[model samples]
Target: MKTPTSPIVAPVALLTSAVLLTSAALLTACSSMGGTSQKFDQASVPESVRVPAGHKVAWETTGRGLITYECRDKANAPGMVEWVFVGPQADLWDRAGRKVGTYYGPPATWEAMDGSKVTATQLAVAPAGEGNLPYQLVKANPAMGSGAMQGVTYIQRVALKGGVAPAMACTMAGKGQRQTVGYQADYIFWKS
Candidate 1:
């Protein structure tokens, strides 16, 4: 009774609805993590350490030395969250860049500064209790990315030892005041 196009249209409509529903669900999940109630004890940072723009940089003391926290705005495209780690070679960056890992929502891709895409083996998030990392919503050019695109709020986080810090050169496309991404826990280590 129905034409071929009629049946096709029904499936197409159903698919479209499904995509919308999935996107909404993912967004809800990411939003639940972004809250201001979370807090962390202050870390001792040297007076000479400079915090970069878009970077909510902070540090705290443990016992001997200290560990630092640096978080950029959230890069909440329709798909997933991405972070840029720039510091020592043995930390999360080097370990994660070598393997391909999958998340619940989408497949994550890590790219190097030279345009080569690296595989992230271990994607470990902080907020070390029993919950997901607090994530804010942001947007950016999908093809170009945070450092290359305009008109998007891309979030990022990096780990640093001692005084070494990540690069602070990324193109941000928004006029809103930046806020602290979330609470974090860092392991402090002393230089030998």
Candidate 2:
């Protein structure tokens, strides 16, 4: 004979399981929302591209998009041609996978959704690996408009993939041609 409480016991157990699963998911979401919770080991980064002492991570983003290259006459080489980098056009996303801003330019710029933006000067670069763009460090110019990008001091480009110039022949016939290659990199912003 079945006890009166047996059906109640099964429903209670199912409810408890559902609550536990929801709690775990919420915890995971909360952890990822704090973008800086993703570890950035300074020691692993080349010193040339590392942020200096006294600066802390202000924002971390993953940039994904295209880098345009043009086939042009090699600088100072009268008859030789080569693929030259034009600029990058990329969307920057936060750790939680939200689109936060954009990176583009002849003057490399990072602009946030709130209208604040910054232009940076390249400070240094180190080899990332074969077929990958080099890691870079840049000093941030004073941000304009005062939102998410305001007060940023430096930016580091790491975890590079692709972005190199096209491997095709840059001959006289190909001169003036342009091509875009896809790339992804992590941009870590720092504040003093």
Q: What local distance difference test score does each model get?
A: 0.30, 0.92
Residue-by-residue lDDT tens digits, candidate 1, 58-119: 21111112122234454665433223332222222112122221111123332333343222
lDDT of the structure predicted as candidate 2: 0.92
For model 2 the TM-score comes to 0.85
lDDT of 2 by residue, 1-192 (tens): 965777689899999999999999999888868734656777778989989899998888999999999999999999999999999999999888889999999889999999999999999999999999999999999999989999999999999999999887778998999999999999999999
Give the root-mean-square deviation of each candidate in angstroms. 20.8, 4.0
Over 4 Å off, model 1: 1-5, 33-55, 58-192
